[model samples]
Target: MSQSVHMSVLLDEVLTALGDIKDKLVVDGTFGAGGYTRAFLEHGARVIGFDRDARVKPYVDAVSAEFPDSFQWINRPFSEMAEGLADVGVEAVDAVVLDIGVSSMQLDEAERGFSFMRDGPLDMRMSIDGRSAADIVNEDSAEDIAHVIWLYGEERKSRGIAAAIVRRRAEQKFERTLDLAEVVERALGGRRGAPVHPATRTFQGLRIAVNDELGELERALEVSEAVIKTGGVLAVVTFHSLEDRIVKNFFAERCGKLPSGSRYAPEVKAANDPTYELVTHKAQGPSDAELARNPRSRSAKLRAGRRTAAATWSEQTVSGKPSTNKVRS
Candidate 1:
């Protein structure tokens, strides 16, 4: 595979949050293009990079050639980092950094079908396996499609867009990115000078639903708690509101920042000790200079926390309520 150019978002901020890493074992959970891994290796840290996309082999090979003794690649999702690391006789790491969402390389590759601007096969699977965006658009019911767009995309015209997709697919199955984009655009009244494309949310919803991106992030957050040693940092960079919310909530709950119940009820204390301390009280955004250099980093937000010596909580004890935002399979 040819090398694809990808600039890691908030590279400096993430490094600052991680502090010094000389001789530390760091895990680059989302090792897209090896951007963060390369930086970590260069700073005298042994890096274990994880990515599900097979196309990243070239970048992995390049990193391995440069730092053969300090770099290792795992062909798996970041959520499964615990198992992958255990397979190599590793237990915990000094730090874990996750750059969430689809990479720029995936969006630029027309064949990946991550962008509506470029026409190609309607496939958006990061792993290049399982269901694709075309499968969801062409096979799911109108109501199901609307739920995905509404819940994941946060689009208001989801029902109309889904209805339009179903109507178009009857005459011809949706097989291309531009075909679906056009259908959504027409359904939303041709954008009418909107700041962003009409199909952007719909595409985002489909991509998230196809890969269970939100679910994977939640799992990764939980696993990071177990795999990161005490005092190790867990830095997450989210690109959208949904992702940022999950990360924020996870940090709040883990840091013993839970909400009080009700005025009628007596005050209840946290069941378990805090597992992490907030590295930053608020999420960090890109600077003006960085924003001008990369417009795509505008929506990026970085939130991090350092693990404590407390015991890890069980999944059930961590949160009283189950997640309802997950897309139905």
Candidate 2:
């Protein structure tokens, strides 16, 4: 994973946070290009790595050749780990590390349609199946499209973009990534002096929607909570605010950091005792040195928690607040 990952952000911070897994088994939840798993293996921990992309098979095979008995690769979404790992005779893991959102490998491959930098089919599924971004653009209602762009991308001009997409698609359906990107840029008034390309947020939103990324992330965190043993570490590295916000709130809720709210809307407290202690009270960013080495990590944020001996929270107790939209830690 490190071979393709090139650099892992907050590498020192994550290793230090996990303490010494040593001989314990660790789950590399995302396995993107293998950065975390490589580090975990090097540190003497057995790794159970998960990923949906078949492109990682070569990297997984290479690691397997070297580590033999210590590494296992599961070609599935990280969200499936709870039941999947249990089925394989593993109930709990020493630590779980998730590097959320699209990987550098995916983004760089124009054929994957994760980026509009080079023209390619608008197919953004991490797996071979599922509805493609082109499908949504060509099939979804403008209002629905607007909702996805607004909610997932947090784009203020989503409605106009959706309208433009609709008008253009009526004449000729979007097929190429750059075609949609150009339409969005025009809809947003040709970028002006913006630092990033005009289509970045829309592409991000589409990718998230196409892959059900937020839902997958929510599930992965919940599953990790169930499978990490007492005193086990759960570290998450998120690239954007959407992922960071959920992680922060989950950590806050699990660590008893959130206060009981108003009488009308009281705080979501755990019926069981607090399940985790904050390994990171606030999100950690890439250090100056890391940023210098890999500028792509500039937006990365890492948050971690150490599980307690107490019981995990029930789903009903966590229903009081919207975990996805809660205040960040």
Q: Which candidate achieves the best lDDT against the true structure? A: 1
What are the lDDT scores of the predictions, listed in order? 0.89, 0.87
Q: Give per-model CA RMSD.
A: 5.6, 5.2
Candidate 2 deviation (Cα RMSD): 5.2
Shift in Å, residue 269, candidate 2: 5.2
lDDT for model 2: 0.87
Worst 10 residues of 1 by lDDT: 320-329
Compared with the true structure, model 2 gives a TM-score of 0.91
How would you encode candidate 1's per-residue C-alpha lDDT over 25-139 as one tens digit per residue? 9999998888889888888999999999989888899999999999999999999998999999888899999999999989999999999999999999999789999999989
In candidate 2, where is summed lDDT lowest over 10 consecutive residues? 320-329
Give the Å error, residue 2, model 1: 9.7
Where in model 1 is the C-alpha error above 4 Å? 1-4, 260-269, 315-329
